[model samples]
Target: MIERLISLWPARTGAAPIVPERSVAGRTLLLLITIMSFLSAVTLGGVVLMQKSAIAWSADVGREVTIQLRPVEGEVMDSNLRSAVSLAESTPGVASARALSIEESQKLLEPWLGSGLDLTAIEIPRLVVVQLSDPAEADIEGLQRNLGAVKGASLDTHAAWRQQLNTMAGTIVFSGLMVLVLIGAATVLAIIFATRGAMATNREIVDVLHYIGASNRFIAGEFQGRFLSIGLQGGLLGAVMALVFFALIGTAAGSMLPSEAGAQVGVLFGRFALGWSGLFGILAVVPVIAALTAITSRTTVRRFLSETS
Candidate 1:
């Protein structure tokens, strides 16, 4: 076998690429990489959007506190509301306190209790919205203690809701990272299989090169270069497709803005906007994919050569 492969060695070196320029397997691998890249980009974009929206929501919720006055058998609702508002406004770090009218409170409950029903007979609690000059500076415990003295008045700092939001955001981010890691592992495995297949197809050529004193590093470099190009091509195409997908979704979200559904979507995604950092983050995947492909191919080739030797 050694003598046969030595005889088969070409007289001219570097006449053509060691790996075939194109093949069915190459195209299939390209398609796989493209799909992986697309999914990865979409996941990253979603994580960024959710993170920003969650932060904004937490900040908005933190800046305001609510005081609810429940109806007492003998106490006047209007008087209790006024006293609560006055107490809140007098507190340090309180920006402004406004008590919602009965009509306004009824509107808030309309979605849950249904419209056209008489809320007057329900004996619902009235709310006083208290905005803070700075959330960090506000003395929440003191205000809560003071509100405890008032009849049927309670202060809600929204601390529980904010903590839940933070937990949810963290969970989402961790899930996204796990997904990315899985995608990377899958890509590496695909490249390893592809590299071995390429080596098998060009077995005779590789043997000849080895017999003719060609180094393993030289052989590995050729495969690495080929796969790197494929990685870049696939990654760029996938990234572009992801961007287009986001654009279409954003346009649709914008059109839905006038409707009730649109308002809900706006609250969730905040216009589906990925800022400049997010865009750059998506673009950065191309080089990373390319590097991963090259490294995986080189390592695979070197391992195959060593095993055969």
Candidate 2:
């Protein structure tokens, strides 16, 4: 039965079935790279956004300053708080200064402490939240010296928040860059592997072409043409899929975020709008990787044939 099957597999002359060319094109490789690159790009883009949002939130929350009054641990804190408020209101670059009410202090602590916690017995420190017209214009060092004039008062303008924002943004952008680099490397490797496989499988055809006067350049061009199709198919598919995913997720998130935050996201989307850079990257990188793979395989095959013949 095995011998009969083997005999039947041979193409018959004058009635031979037209065998389609053995190709490395089509949805197999294209679809695989398309799905993988799309997912990876979307994930990296989200990481980039998350980092931006974190830094923005930190900056927004700490943009205002706070003044705390401790009246020698026994004296009335209200007198000292009033003095600090008077000082802040008269100071340069200071926009508004208001003493925190009992209710407000409890509101600040409600996230960590339960809603029903008694506050009357506790000697809560008096806090004055200070806003500025422009944070950059606010002389923080000068404000600290002014606060020194007020008895039993200390000023905090969130010096630590700036440092943390820098750290967080750097970490996130660095990670996104690393991921982009890895994706490029993986794409090149995949192309090289697939091209080599196709070359090996078509070794007989390659020898026939060479014998029929096909130059090395012609053979390499043929392979490059096929690989170019695969690269383009994968790249366009990946880019479109990534855009769709980003839009859907961003739309959903916009509805869930607070109005201010939502506005910020919209601004961010506009700022990060896709441009020629992304287009150039896909077109230039994919084709180059494919062409490189094709040329490398052709060189190896030609060298081997020359050595043996």
Candidate 3:
């Protein structure tokens, strides 16, 4: 019965490999699975990275708050800055408080306005950064009121922005999961189509085998093995391709960004250097894909045989 598929490609496989080595349709199916796996892997990796970035962003935000001393003609800007820094430092739950120097503030603006900008011509508020021991334990409302008592002072922790970022990250992860589910479904359908087509192509041999007392499982096993091998090959190819894509993106970003900016970006997005665990996670896709392919093929073949008999 196995000899029937042996002639699937006379030029490629004479008898050694009987399943799907040389079948044009089989190769096309494999290619389709490979592309689908690639898309799935990329999205899966993106979700994983985004999750990590969200954690980092949350930690960074959760640890700090900023006190802005808006410029006012009636209030002494320097005195207000000093008073705000001292109040934050003396306050309970506050870890440290420091104001950015004029040069440092100018450096922050350099990215947008470039260097050599006039500092005295325009009024720029002093930025006093406040770190908390534990954001959860900190008395944020009390601290805000205390800071507001100082002239021209306002407090901002960027909670709104952080919440928005977290929402965006969750949306991306949910979207990625949906895409993976669709891809998996498409893969199963493709496997079913390929299995049924194989059965139809070798219907004569299969029918003969059935009459001679062959069980459905025995008939399905051959197709399962072939499809499993194809699935494994495609899965590995996809993982490798995804890794390469990420590595290239990392390299390009490193080259284009300044050292300080690159470091900041790494803190936000990770170094893009997925360690051994991440590699193992991606490589794990191989066995999973193979199992899905094998099961889908086996089930489809058995159903088809049962209906025909």
Candidate 4:
């Protein structure tokens, strides 16, 4: 089976590598590295997307404040809404304020309350959106105090929601980093074992090279270069697979998920779009994996040679 897989590879054009490139051990290591790289890329891309989405969520929430006007005895909602809007618009650091239409408000409730219900029969509170020029400059306390003067008016800065979002984002990003670290450690260990196996398989060749006064660096370099090639091939393939995987998910998300689910997904991942930064980060995995493979192989080879000598 190994020989058959080896035969699938294009024939070498010149002298063979010091470390046998077409062996079961090499193929296995390549597959392992490919799997590791794929997982790493996916994890990294997910983290980037989540982090960006979280930032967008926070920024959007921060830039807007909400005012809810509850009905009071003998108080007109329209007057209260106008009062709130005027107060919000005149407030320092506020950009604009607008009350949501009854229809729009009904739509917001449609997800919870079935459609076409008589909302007018119920004492539904009216909502006004206040846009902030800059959250840092916004006098939230003053706005809250001023809104307190309006009949049944209350201000919501969404501070609690934003805090929760930040906490969630931080946890997810930290988890992703931990996963990447674990994957790297696993890859390093795999490379070390593969290097040792390669050295053992080519023990006679190594002995001959040493007898000919080849330095440890030279022998290590040979193994390092060979493993580096394997790593590159595996990493590239894995990265491509990961890209395809994300692309498929992005395409499927719109058509496959239910409307509500899709909306939630959009809120979380923004149509599964990994911008240029994410693409670059994924591509960077290939070279990083290759470098790690080369370094691990070289170190393992040197250690083995020293022990034998």
- Scanning candidate 3 in windows of ten residues, the lowest lDDT window is 9-18
- In candidate 3, the residue pairs with backbone N, CA or C atoms under 3 Å apart (3 or more residues apart, or in different chains) clash, namely none
The candidate that achieves the highest TM-score relative to the unseen native structure: 1
Off by over 4 Å in 1: 1-16, 256-258
- Candidate 3 per-residue C-alpha lDDT over 234-273 given as tens digits, one digit per residue, 9 for 90 to 100: 8888888888888887896688889998888787668776
Rank by TM-score (best first): 1, 4, 3, 2
Q: Which candidate, 1 or 3, would have the higher lDDT against the true structure?
A: 1
Total backbone collisions for each predicted model:
0, 0, 0, 0
In candidate 2, residue 105 scores what lDDT?
88
- What does candidate 1's lDDT look like per residue over 14-90, in tens digits? 45458888887799889999999999899999998899899999999999999999888999988888888888988
Q: Higher TM-score: candidate 2 or 4? A: 4
lDDT of 2: 0.65
Which residue pairs show backbone clashes in model 1? none
Q: Give the C-alpha lDDT of model 1.
A: 0.89
Task: After superposing candidate 3 on the true structure, give the runs of residues whose Cα lies further than 4 Å from its correct spot.
Answer: 1-21, 106-119, 255-268
Query: What lDDT would each prediction earn against the true structure?
Result: 0.89, 0.65, 0.82, 0.91
Error of 4 at 281 (Å): 0.5
How much does candidate 3 score in TM-score?
0.83
> Candidate 1, 178: how far from true, in Å?
1.2
Kindly list the per-residue Cα lDDT of model 4 for residues 87-107, writing each as its tens digit: 998889999999999888888
Compute the lDDT of residue 4 as modeled in candidate 1: 56
